[model samples]
Target: QQYLERLKNKQVVRFASQAPAHPLWPEIERVTLEQLQYARLGVEGGVWQLFAEDGEMKMYKREEEVDGLAVDPLKAVHTVKGVTGREMTHYFFSPDVRFEWETTLEQMKVLETIADDTLVILQIHKRVWPASQRDALFWSHVRRVPNDTDRDAQDIWIACNHSTEHHEAPSNEGKMVRVALTVCLVCQTSIEPPADGGPVTRDHLTCKITYCSVVNPGGWVPTSALRAVYKREYPKFLKRFTQYVKDRCDKQPILF
Candidate 1:
């Protein structure tokens, strides 16, 4: 309720018609659309392998490179109890609750609101050992996508974040090492009807989540250090985030 009220009252940010002239606009759009495609298909093509699994959560990663820089693509699938896709996406997209669950986030701010469902964000992450502090500038967008495969199913919700650039917040010029990344969080809700026709409760529902990310540290960092950071951070991040949602949702009324 607090989140819904705040969003209702907050003023939407406007953008110029020539906003496309921004250097990162094209790349942002391209990455966002590409991520949406991957999110829709999920881990279906066998391109993503299950690298780690903890209970209901499974993490996958594919090794790739860009100009000698290590660019690893990651995908994770998990099921959380007692939440809908809308609720999960809302909490993830909302800045109000991000700091609560994102342990590595040192600082975050919204640079601009392109629309009600889209915004440009600037975030500085805590420094890992042997590596400098890192900052990311990205455009985040959230929306509900129709489930064509099952017309009767609820729509899938997605929150996509892609690294971008703006003159006001230049990258790699400051103390923090700039990191380029594209991240997507997709959620699909599943609800089972009670056999006895009792009132539907959280026990009858689950939210399936698909998370994909490709992070490229801007300056030359040792590939070994980068891989180590990812190996530790990715799994921990997912577990913390899901547990955060489960705890919060359990305390409040279901927001379906």
Candidate 2:
């Protein structure tokens, strides 16, 4: 009862966009509002569907026959609507995709508790960005920069070099080389750390490279492009650039 009371009092600031200059006037569809309400309920109940793709064929009646039975696959997806700046959550359950769901749910719970965590993060962001900054930044901005809607691939590259130039130059000098680069759906340029230090800081930009796979593939490359640089010499870069790529031509312009 106490926890429920506290949740009721949790106020998240919501933003209202300006009306589009169209015949529809307020243009807000009823179905959209219903979807938002359903999403809110989903988050409140922690109501997740336990579904399988292949139905009965995907599973066995008993657990012992590991060799004879087919595997069942499931997806755990939820949404956090009504809360300002919260993103939807999704989990794919393959043969043994368990820990990722636990970790993802834990993250969602953390977001739910903080309420204003994303807003505070945006407020403290080091970049001189506008209040209405692009939405991709809300999720995995740096990782998605290669094919980002707002910034171009070249623009992203410049930002990457500019971001780390101040901190890395004094220490790495000639040792630093352009090993790998990528743009994402959130913003344009993100560079891997040099052979020395792991990405200078986690300040929203240093997304783990493995997760880069989630980003749109149009403008980005796999991290393997930094192959020439030996691992020991560039431990930091090597650590993150294990599968790095070196192109940003794949992204298409975003409309809307």
Candidate 3:
């Protein structure tokens, strides 16, 4: 009887995401809010060094390592003329459109839908040569946070993804290397009333976006190569993702 009880407990932990009461849910909420705060803070001081730039987009990073592994923290901010934070959050959080914007993803699946605004997902990324392909399993949440600081500014929208476990999709299984990552995306929208006092159009909106991520490659990959890959990929990702959102939002009713 004791052995059977132990087996049941094991099974519960194995499928924790699907359990009646999910573990780490509180932590997920706390960390996600904290990430939004961090995103709003300005990146200054000597810790962050600017590495990439394009017009209104600027990228910063701090050089750091763990056991000789490159686990650099990245921050990027971009501004767009016509989209809202809600629209950006919508496309980013929706699993159906991920492949359209996330270029490196080879496969993606939603393991469980935790709620209307949250889910547990797994993704397999295309291999970066001379390294094993990678996979990530995590909980993703989307939220709207109040903007008390700027009374005139629209509410902020956020999408946060943090690593988590699953029974069927065990880590480091098969040929793929598992990656642990905490990624946060925050956006603030602003509106400019039409000069003609007419209906608000795309030209009357703008969005401010901040993206922060810390990715830990579970297995070893050359430090130089990892940094180079990040330097090249991060910029492209933000550009493509924002562009896609703008293109999609263009054809639809403005999400205010």
Candidate 4:
């Protein structure tokens, strides 16, 4: 109750000016590029040793830890039908439609619109049994990069979300456990033109998606439990999110 009151009364601070020329912009861009490279490596194999498979999705986790916390990085790649990279990325990056698809999200607030393509968000996630409720504050950026390999190929779209600090929302001082996380979603569109010269439809396009996340649960929790949650949540999250995009896009005109 006290925590909730503090949260409700906490003033929201805007850091618009800091974002445009923010010192973190360079790091964000560098990390984005690195995630792109990692995504490609995931597809090519030899890295990101596979751990689990579900239907069309293959999940992989690197062998590493940070400060006795399970910082095991995760990467998953899957192909979803009836969607383009642009359409999938739009839905993933937009917070307006997040609650409709994200099952674990309890509450989400946009703290600031840093830029047209950048934003700071605060989110509380529902408690998974044996673990305390978790909250995250992060900056998210979405971009489209040219595909240099195949000049004729569709542009790649990516959304990166990394944990950041805010004066109003101090971490580890509240009742909810803070989560330090960096997540990226990369999408590439594959389009096959019709032999009959017909209008391109949903069936002719697919989005190859790569999702990577490294979450450091603040405060110690059993590593086994954390891994269990990831094994269950990651695939479910991806599958549901993709299906949500596919269903919504089916009702509207094709985007990109």
Candidate 5:
């Protein structure tokens, strides 16, 4: 309690503690790269069905099931004005500010710090009606990659979160049911340089963001109920979060 109060507004510096190599390291690396590629793929493939759209943001999903469970993969693309790729990824990856923007989160904790750019997190989300409370434990990693195709463009940023396990805080040990998810947030920045040849500013930047996630309900949940929740929640989450980041940038120095 004391720590939470003191830590409310401060971003936790990474590498607070070291964790040994994980058995899923190979999967993590593979998934991270795969997501980067998948995210950049255009929606013209005629597979993804568009379900939600607002301004520059569009959300799509493909109906799919795994072992009689609804595990629809979601892909959302959004263009945010006045922020760079680095700024978007920073807010998405930082744990300290999550509560401020993640309206559905009930609690979060860092279970392990794998490196300066990686950490294991435990999060409990507000329960949806007629369903058991849900929790997630995942390893999250953030990195910046050079824009190989567009050398003059600002670097791209990626934040990947994939479900993981922890002995101390095992899932399904309590009333909360665990949800497995793999989420990727990828950002690319475009600059609209000043016509006056002045210095660059946040106003001259726009970040094109791709968010992809596949969540698997650990227990048997009605497919309709799950899809209903996702349809109602995802768009709201993305819009509110991006607005929050824009507001934060307006209030302080932009990360990039």
Candidate 6:
């Protein structure tokens, strides 16, 4: 009764139980340390290890469940972590290319794989709220949905989520030109959209492609020149210029 009252506000508590009932329990009372090595390595190579291990863990198959309730493989728990086949926590592995922020212990608990410093890119979807707000049901459903969001949003959100900056852009071309110069949907930071220097339009705007620094490391490019490069380019440079932006720009620019 005292325990129950205390546990009313607590999440979990352990209780004592009788000894093992197995008929073989008395047969092997003492095992050597060598017998324990396999047990230890198995855990290190098992699911949790796979989760902490570098690189990707291959996904052989999956059932499209509602809220990831059934993603973790059952056989893995006992075989890997020495966790008996009971109601153990489930975890899922995602590539470094895409991952998101998740708040709360419950949200973090379902995860069996993701750890800190994992290289993940961000992806946003409109139908749901941030991972912080979702329940187990929503998290399960999350795996089923196709992740297709603006890379820029993904970029900013991931940086913020991890509280770390991604040094490399989508390509080696640097940040600004790395992504196509267009009116940024999230921040409204764009060079081609005409930001205060004389005449600027879609057809007569300078090429917002800054090959060097990520757009004025310390200085902003004039809007006029930003538009001029795209409009007035020699045939030789036109192909090269087009390819540079084409190679780096992620999604097509939103015309304004």
What's model 1's lDDT at 37? Answer: 84
Model 1, span 3-47: residue lDDT tens: 987765562322222335555567656776678788667566777
Evaluate model 1: give its TM-score. 0.85
Estimate candidate 2's alpha-carbon lDDT, on a 0 to 1 scale.
Answer: 0.20
What is residue 21's positional error in candidate 4, in angstroms? 3.9
Q: State the lDDT of candidate 4 residue by residue for 1-256, as single tens digits.
A: 9998776566323212245486668877787788788777734546567877888889888867788888888989899989988888888889999998899899999987877778889999998877889999998888788899999999999988999887768885768999998999999999898899999898899889998889889867889888888888888889899999988899578877
Worst 10 residues of 6 by lDDT: 179-188
lDDT of prediction 1? 0.82
* Pick by TM-score: 2 or 3, better one: 3
What overall lDDT, based on C-alpha atoms, would model 6 receive against the true structure? Answer: 0.21
Q: Sort the predicted structures by lDDT, highest score first.
A: 3, 5, 4, 1, 6, 2
Per candidate, the number of residue pairs that clash is 0, 25, 0, 0, 0, 15
- Please give the range of 10 consecutive residues that has the lowest summed lDDT in model 4: 11-20
- What TM-score does each of the candidates earn? 0.85, 0.17, 0.90, 0.87, 0.89, 0.13
Q: Write the per-residue lDDT of candidate 2 for residues 1-256, one digit (tens) a residue.
A: 9987776566211222222232222212332233223322321233332221121111011111123322111111211111111011111111122233222111111111112111101101111112111111111111111234444322221101001111212323332122111211111223333456653321212221111111111122222331211112223322222212211111312111
**lDDT of each residue in 51-159, candidate 3, tens digit only:** 9999899999998888878889999999988999999998999999999999999999999888767889999999998888999999898878878888777899999
In angstroms, how far off is 156's CA in candidate 1? 0.2
How many angstroms is residue 85 displaced in model 1 relative to the true structure, after the best TM-score fit?
1.0
Global lDDT of each model? 0.82, 0.20, 0.89, 0.84, 0.88, 0.21
Clash pairs, candidate 3, are none
Between candidates 3 and 6, name the one with more favorable TM-score.
3
